[model samples]
Target: MFKLLLLCLALLPAFAGAQEDSDWIEYRDAYRQMIWFEKYGKPKQFLQNHFRIRPRDKSVPTDGLRLTLNGKATHVALPLDALGRAVFPFSKAAYDDNAELAVNRKAGQLKSGAWVSIVTRPDGVYAAADLRTACDQLLAYLRYSGEAAGKSCAGVQFSYPKNDVSQVQFHAAGGAVTMLAPKEGPAFSGDAVTTFRVFVYRFAALPETGQVVTSSTPLAIAALLE
Candidate 1:
């Protein structure tokens, strides 16, 4: 029994090494899958085809998922059906309107309103840390001016188009804010490539929340940009 115990202890290092190798392989596979999604336009196309929820059907279901944002105090419940279909409160019109509001607010057009900025980092900025620094500065400015709600934000990550998959991480904590990986592919700058897009949330509540009681389809999806 003592000799068998010693043998098991001696093999522990080899077992640990094998586990590390397995973990690395799985990580690499995730990257590969991300690349495949980009190549075929999976998530984007899939949403367009399958999960296209109409405005008429955008009612607040009783058994929906409840979520909070801009601090845990602000309660928000979203409509998520058993079919795994999550109807996001986003539309082209809404995005255009909020984007205009954001621009006007930045240019001193609006006196008192909320708006979020689409912060883009170009390839000229080599280091990811430096790019994030720029975003952080912009975020600080928005927060100090009282133009933004909570700090729901996301950073962009660019990867080689054909060789490997994109590496994007999505993290959402309690009510502070949520961060998402950037959409993969080539974003053309005027002369260079855009590395990533950092979307900063800075908006008041949606326009139609007063009339609605429960968590209905989102009227304004500006927050979902994160």
Candidate 2:
């Protein structure tokens, strides 16, 4: 019986490590099908948003992005100030106040805070300085995959003027994306069609070692462009 007790004590470290590995949970929005990660039941990444579709009903708020978090509908407005600057409503304080951390503990990706980027183009005839237009050039890249030279490389790239923030380019690729826009023309099109492509770059980095991690299926995203 003493030997049995000793064996249990020896395995305690491994059991605790496994539990820590499984601490995170994924939450996905059903309406747009975007995924987010949480650690200890709080959002690790800021909320993701997009505006490629304008509902026929004018009653709906199409000027900003709306999401359903924890059974409650939350909105984040995309506004451009009079000085022609971008305005995001989700400040750290605002997020803390409204986030539904305990609501959907069972949902999202397997990890916390995914690195991603998005590309959008205009579809309708609104003012050029409108919220949607202001956000057209918003680009974010949080992860780095070190497979740019490989045949199967998948990543995002863009070019912008030194001072101009309004004019920019956006693109997606199955391999290393070199250009700012699609080269082979758009695969899909419509009279009221605006394209918003999201790229989920697969990358991993060791904080202690500073080594690059590459994924076989690195680039992925479910674009709710319809």
By TM-score, the best candidate is: 2
Off by over 4 Å in 1: 1-125, 157-226
For model 2, how does the per-residue alpha-carbon lDDT over 1-226 read when each residue is reduced to its tens digit?
0000000111111111113222211122111122221111332232233211222222333233322223135433334321111212223443444433121112221112122222222331112122122222121111112211222212222212222222122212222222122221111121111222322212111111121111212111211111
* Lowest lDDT 10-residue stretch of candidate 1: 1-10
Backbone steric clashes in candidate 1, count: 0
* C-alpha local distance difference test of each model: 0.24, 0.21
Q: Residue pairs in steric clash, candidate 2?
A: 26-107, 26-108, 27-107, 27-108
Give the per-residue lDDT digits (tens) of candidate 1, residues 81-164: 322223233233333333211110111111111122223223221233333443444344434434334654343222233323
The estimated TM-scores of all candidates read 0.20, 0.20
What is the overall TM-score of model 2 with all chains considered together? 0.20
